[model samples]
Target: MRIVIALGGNAMLQRGQPLEAAIQRENIRKAAEVIARVAKDHEVILTHGNGPQVGLLALQNAAYDKVSPYPLDVLGAETAGMIGYMMEQELYNQMPGAQIATMVTQTLVDNNDPAFQDPTKFVGPVYGKEEAEALAAEKNWSIKADGEYFRRVVPSPLPKSIIEVEMVKKLSEMGALVICSGGGGVPVRKLEDGKLEGVEAVVDKDLTAALLAEQMGADALVIMTDVAAVCVNFGQPDQKKIHKASVQGIGELDFPAGSMGPKIDSCAQFVEKGGRFAAIGSLYDVEKIVTGEAGTWITNEVEGISFYEKKEEAAVA
Candidate 1:
C-alpha cells in the first residue's frame, strides 16, 4: 500500500517539556520504530508538523539581539530540515535497508488570501498577559490569548498546490521512503513570471498532506496526531471518540479550528477527492493503527466495516 503519513507537532514535543535535542531525538526514535514497521509493507511518504520547533526558533531569535529574526516561511523550512535529519537518522537505524529521502517542499498559496490580512494562527511560546503586551511592544509581534496563555499569531493560508509534486511521486515510484512537505511546505506564492516566492505564512500540514496524497495517488493518508480518534466535545465531560466516520458525518461534528478541525477536514477532503481512506491516530500506535488494530478510519462508504475492520474481518475469514 502507498501511504502518506502526517506527524503532529505536540506528538514530538509534550506540553511543558523542555525543548532539548535529546528529547526530540528520542521521540523520533520511538516514532521511527512505528514507521519502520509500516515501511516494511507500504510505500511510505512522511510529513510532519513544526509548530513547536519553529516556535522555539522564534523564541531563540527573541532572546538574541545580534542575530536577525527569520520569517515564518524560512523558519518552517529550517524545522523541516532539522526534523527531517532526525527522522532520517532514526528511521535508517530502525529500517536498515530502506531508502529514505527528504525534500524541502514548497506549497502554493494565493497572495490575496484573507488570512494574510488577518493573522490568527498561533505560534511560539505561551506567555502571561503582561509579558505578551511587553513583547508586542518590543518586537511588534501579534499576540493572542490561547485558553489561559498568550501566543504569537501568524497567517495560515490555504494550500493550493504542491510545487514538488512530480518529484515526490517519482521518488515514491522508485521505492524510496520519502519525507517531504514539512510544516505545510513553506507557504509560497507563484508570480506571473512563474517564479515561486516565499510568503510570511504557514500552510495547514493536514491540508498539505491531503494534497500530497492526492497528487501522489496514495492508497491512504494516515494523520498521526496526539489523539487516537476524532472526538466530539474534545476535553469536555461529554467528549466521545468516533471510531469510524464518513466525510459528511465528520463535518457535522463540532471541532475547534486550531485543533482536531483541520485533520477531519483533510481526511474528508481526501475521501471526497477519490482517495481510498484516511486514518487518524496516535503516533505511538501507528503500526497497530495501519494494521487495523487502532485509529479511526474515514471513508466514503458507511454501510460495511471500515478499512481497518474489513482488513481484520478478511484476515479472520
Candidate 2:
C-alpha cells in the first residue's frame, strides 16, 4: 500500500530541550528507523512539522541588527531543506540502496485567511511567564500559554493545494521514498498577476499531509507522534483511549487546538474524502499503527471495537 506519514514537531525534538544539531539528528535517526521499517513494505511519502525549528531561526535572525529578520517563508524553506536533509540521510543509512528524495514543496494558502488575523500556532522554545511577556512586548509577538511554559503564536492558514504534488506523486509511484511539505510547504499565496508569493503565515502540516494522501491516492495516512493514542479528557482520571472510532465519534472529544486537534481533524478529512484509513500513534510503534494493532484508527465505517467498549466488556466479564 502507498502510505503518507506526517511527523509531528514534538516527535522530531522534545519540548524544552536545547536546540542543538546533534540532538535533533539523533531524534531524526530514531524516527528514520521506524520510517525505514514501513517503507520496506509500502511506497512511503513523508511530511513533517517545523514549528520549533523555524521559530528558532526567526529568533536568531532578529539578533542581527544590520538586516531585518527573514520572513517566515524563507525560514520555512530553510527548515524544509535542513530537516529534509537530515531525514534523507538517516533514512538512507537505515535502508541502503533505497531511492529517497526530498523535495522543497510549496503549499498555497489564502492571503485573506482569517488565520492571519488570529495567530494561534505556537513556535520556538518555551519561556517563563515573565520572560515570555517581555519578549512579546519587545517583538510585538502573540504569546500563548503552552502547558507550564509560554511560546510565540503565529497565524496558521489552511493549505489549499500542494504546488509540487504532481512531481511528488510521480516520484512515489516510481518507488522512491519521497519527503516533502516541510513546515506545510512554505506557505504561499497567489497574486493577482498569476504569480506565487510567500506569505507571513504557518500552515498546519497534518492537514497538508492529509491533502497529499488524498491527491496521491494513498491507502492510509499514518501520523507518527509522541503519544500512543488519541484519548478523551486527556491527563485526567476519566481519560479513555480511543482504539478505533468513526469520524463523528472522534469529533465528540475536545482536543487542544495547539496539539492533537489538527491530527484528528486531518484524519477525519482524509476518511471523508474516501481514503481507506488513518492512524495516529507513537512513532516507535509505526508497524502496529499501520496494521491497526495499536493507535487510534479513524474510518467512516462505524462497526469495530473501541477502547471504551473493550473496557466495558472486560468489566462485565
Candidate 3:
C-alpha cells in the first residue's frame, strides 16, 4: 500500500512543555519508531508540520538585527530540511539497512490569491496582549488575539501543485522511505518568464498532503495528529469521537479551521477525488490505524448505502 502520512506539529513537541532541542529530538525519535514500523509494510511518503519550529526561527531572527530576517517561505523550506534531517537520522537509527530520502519540495500557488490580501493564517510565537500590540505597532503585522495570547497571521494560499510530486512518487516506489512537502511545501508563484518565486504564505500541511495523495495515486492519506480520532463538539460536554464516516457525513460535522477542520476537509477532498480511504488518528497509534483497528476512517461511500447496490448504481450512489 502507498500511504501519505501528514505529521502534526505536536508530534515533535510535548504538550505544555518547553520547546527544547533535546526534547524535540527525543520526540522525533519516538515518532520515527512508529513510522519505521509502517514503512516496513507499506510505501510511505512523510510530510510534517513546522508551526512551532518556524515560529522559533522567526523569534531568533527578531533577537538579532545584524542578520537578514528570513521570510516565511524560506523558513518553511528550511524547516523542511531541518525536520527532514531529524526524521531521516532517527529512522536510520531505528532501521539501519533501510534507505531514506528527503526532498525540499516547492508547491505552486496562485499569485493573485485573495488570501494574500487578507492574511488570516497564524504563525510565529504567542505573546501577551500588551506585547502583541507593541510588536504589531513596531512591525505593522496583522496581529490577532488567540484566546489568552496573540500570534502573527499570514496568508494561507491553496496548493495548486507539488513541484516534486513525480520525484517523490518514484522514490517511494523504489523501496525508499521519502520525506517531502514539509510545512505544507514552500509556497511559490510561477512568474511569466517561467521562473518560480517564493511567496510569503503557509499552505496547510493536511491540504497539501491530500493534493499529493491525489497526484501520486496514493491508497490512503493518513493524518496523524495529537487526537486519537476526530470528535464532534470538541472539548465540550457532548463531544463524540468519530470512528468511521462517509465523506458526506464528515462535511456536516462542526470542526474548527485551525484544529480538526482542515483535516476533515482534506480527507473529504481525497475521497471525492477517487482515493479509497483517509484516516485521522493519534501519532502514537499509527501502526494500529494502518491496520484498520483504529482511527476515524473516511470512505467514499454514503452512510446508508447498501452493499448489494448495482455497480452502476454504486457509482453515483
Q: List the global CA lDDT of all models.
A: 0.84, 0.89, 0.84
Write down the TM-score for model 2: 0.95
Candidate with best lDDT: 2
Q: What is the TM-score of each candidate against the true structure?
A: 0.91, 0.95, 0.91
Q: Write the per-residue lDDT of candidate 2 for residues 56-118, one digit (tens) a residue.
A: 999999999799788999999999999999999999999999999999999999998999999
> Sort by lDDT, best first: what order?
2, 3, 1
Comparing 1 and 2 by TM-score, which wins?
A: 2
Best by TM-score: 2
Model 2 misplaced stretches (Cα beyond 4 Å): 308-317
Q: Which order, best to worst by TM-score?
A: 2, 3, 1
Prediction 1 TM-score vs. true: 0.91
Candidate 1 lDDT: 0.84
RMSD to the hidden true structure, all candidates: 3.9, 2.8, 5.9
Whichever of 2 and 3 has more TM-score, that candidate is 2
